[model samples]
Target: MTFRHAADPVAVTADNWIHTSVLVLNASYEALDEIAADRAVVLIIGGAAEAIADRESYFAIRSTRVEVPLPQTIRLRRYVYIEHVPHGGDQSRATLAGVLRRDRHRCGYCAGWARTVDHIRPRSRGGPNTWDNLVACCVACNTAKADHTPEEVGMRLLWQPKAPTHRAKQQRKIWRQLAAGHA
Candidate 1:
């Protein structure tokens, strides 16, 4: 698809195009990230990147000085180095906020609204603050569970907890492609 901005061929409101997805490419033309159309336009105008592909339906973003088409894909003008961080393991400590977000703030036992976190294996018994050991819990469930393990209290867990997977595979594939191109 292509976009035209000259003479304002068609009126495109910011509200209509702001939510559009724009694929971002690194300076080497490797996929980097996906960002909103408005942000992409800002990057393009700021001279940090240039549009590689414009949307098929021409949408004009007009200014007193110039106009530009909404971009479908953009490439950075300079190479950006990003440091990779390893995903946390089962032994890694988890935060209360992280646990709540992972469970979508729903009780692990009853699927009710959860404002607190529960330890599957009681902390008193040496349960670590790891992703696999923590679960979001409602106030009532937390009180009932006390310092006892779920098995001991006869309360079955609705789901087994584990460390959340980051986009490692996708990132590896992109890296491989970049390596091959360099070779």
Candidate 2:
């Protein structure tokens, strides 16, 4: 769409359109990643990809020699391999930092800001440092439950401990594919 003053008709409706997310698919139609709309357009214009779906309400972006309807999804012309990164899970080793991050620094017992992680079953009792056994804890709560399970301390956890849910974005393989001209 053409850029104009906000009050002008047919103006660029969204100043942040370039930052809009566009899903990218592998040539085999497997899902790959979400990329910026601008990048998707470049891929379309450069003949590296094809639009699979257009944006809702029919918005379009124009450059000096090309005008492409903004895309909601695009597919690469060539199939590329994606490597899956091992993700954190309930049984995975839970590091102090990872636990705090997963819990968003909120104590599992009191829902207060947490600076540490506590073992649901005290380490001395053979608690493994796994996601299922750890919770973010404030200094006070940690001290109060020291060397004891929540049941023994008569404290109840506000939330269950678990691994954070995050999609595994592909990495490293893109470079290799590009080097081999398969991207």
Best by TM-score: 1
lDDT of each: 0.76, 0.77
**Could you tell me every candidate's TM-score relative to the true structure?**
0.55, 0.54
Q: How well is each residue in 66-131 modelled by candidate 1, as lDDT tens digits?
A: 788988899977776654546544333688987887788989999999999999998999998889
lDDT of 2 by residue, 110-136 (tens): 999999899999999999888889999
The candidate that wins on lDDT is 2
User: What are the clash counts of all predictions, listed in order?
Assistant: 2, 1
Model 1, backbone clash pairs (residues 3+ apart or across chains), number? 2
